[model samples]
Target: MMTSLFDQFASPTMLGIPLIVIAVMLPWTMFPSPTPQWVTNRVITIQMWLANRFTNQLMTPLSLGGHKWALLLTSLMLYLITINMLGLLPYTFTPTTQLSMNMGFAFPLWLATLIIGMRDQPTMSLGHLLPEGTPVPLIPALIVIETISLFIRPLALGVRLTANLTAGHLLIQLLATAVYVLLPLMPTVALLTAAVFFLLTLLEIAVALIQAYVFVLLLSLYLQENI
Candidate 1:
């Protein structure tokens, strides 16, 4: 009768989310702190390696730009991948499955877009956001609409990842419950449910990566268009 933490609190809510928070954070306290032995975290190591490669290369301006961007994007992708895989473990809470956590990550991304875009080319950033040659009369209306869309990006990003992960997690939970119920009476049904649960695990892995790619790709598009 082995089960997981997810099986215990599949119907999560505001009240219970705190418990999940504690569960997720407990690892930080439980894991032995690293000594000042210059231990390298995987993401940090990758970032340093990429930075060194970029610095060493005699790249053209355009080539250098592409290399820098690719490295930056790859780092983001790796980060998301690591977090998503951590969620697949037993007794672990997937923070990304929570709306608040997803919003936390996504909002900063939108803010960076705004700050970077404006800093690099304020006139073009604000002006280019609207259509190239719209009449002055309609420009105000266009700006309002475009501004709303720009803000909505973070909201959309948060909801998309949270909703997808939440749904997949719930599906696995429900299937596991059904399997538990039918185990003695209908072993075949229970076995089928178990098989489906394994499949869902694989599917969740893909969803995690896909959502990360989507977030980064949309961001890259915004940067390219504005800057």
Candidate 2:
């Protein structure tokens, strides 16, 4: 089996570690960007110039309440999807599969929710977590429950994405390993197993994209709720 170094760890960590590395490496990719440094710098300068030119010309621009947020989220989705799918390469790691990477995204999401919610409904937003309709006697319990729930949203998001990607990658790795392990003992069965693993890799690509979209969609939904 042609396995990457990332596959050496326990199943959970196999995807987790690479995912974290990928997230940390994201910003650095811009420095010596996949493109030539000079090219990248020129592109950046041109983009800035164009953006400034547009800003000066625009007037009475119709904007959504969350237009900035939407653009930010779209950038996030593009970056995450690109990085996650990059793991499909022969020896690359997928950072989206790591706890740290997922949590990095989740933390911002959690904070954004709170900030936007409070901004949108200053007096009612934070307070409405418990809702006025709740019985006065249960307000304390409700508040506690809502607080816990709000905090857990990011945790759930992190765990869900990390676990899904990690499990999928591990499953493919194990299946591939099994093919090699059994090849000498039973050539026919081993070949069939290897074929299965090849199919599994195809499915994993789809899973990777779905996971990225799900994470972005959930984040958007959270912002929508708050906004």
Candidate 3:
């Protein structure tokens, strides 16, 4: 029997147990632990440098109040980057591809930003629901629209990450299947498809990294508006 094209996305299982729990725990194990000594291993040193660079870039636009989010943002970026990149490897499951997982990440954090903004600057936070210099005729309609969009932020964030990764994985699987089937029947065409598949894999790797960065970047922007 032919297998389902989408079966690749099903969460892996072993002895009737889902592997997602393990997948979530796996990323943290990759990071090298830091030492108390002044000098450190190259791995830890490089990790710290990259992390600092990410925080510096992420926090530069925010006010002093937002700087406190540096640790949260940096940790999030690393967690996402590791999970996304690892998913590209064989025999791996990407938790981020699931909307539930993405929303779990998005909603709480997005809500946190909103809560911070409202707590710190209630007038400004509420003002975002209705912009300045609005005509009376458009006032009610604009308020409705803005309120809808504000709540839509977390949904958009969850969907964007899930959709992109799912689409890329689906396309990669389809192309690889085509190449495998045509290898004997049509050598030249199979060769072309194989080349395309190779290029597509590289693009997917970049997407994994870029999507992680964009996720964190948007969070930072949300925090900026609030704090």
Off by over 4 Å in 3: none
Rate residue 139 of model 1 by lDDT: 88
| Per-candidate TM-score against the hidden true structure | 0.68, 0.71, 0.97
lDDT of 1: 0.70
> Model 1, 53-86: lDDT tens per residue?
6334312233333345665666566566666676
lDDT of 2 by residue, 158-189 (tens): 99888888888788878987998999999999
165 Cα displacement, candidate 3 (Å): 0.3
Candidate 2 segments whose C-alpha is farther than 4 A from its true place: 1-63
lDDT of 3 by residue, 119-224 (tens): 9899999999888999999999999999999999999999999999999999988898899999999999999999999999999999999999999999999998
| Residue-level lDDT for 162 in candidate 2 | 88
Question: If ranked by TM-score, best first, what sequence of candidates would result?
Answer: 3, 2, 1
TM match of model 2 to true structure? 0.71
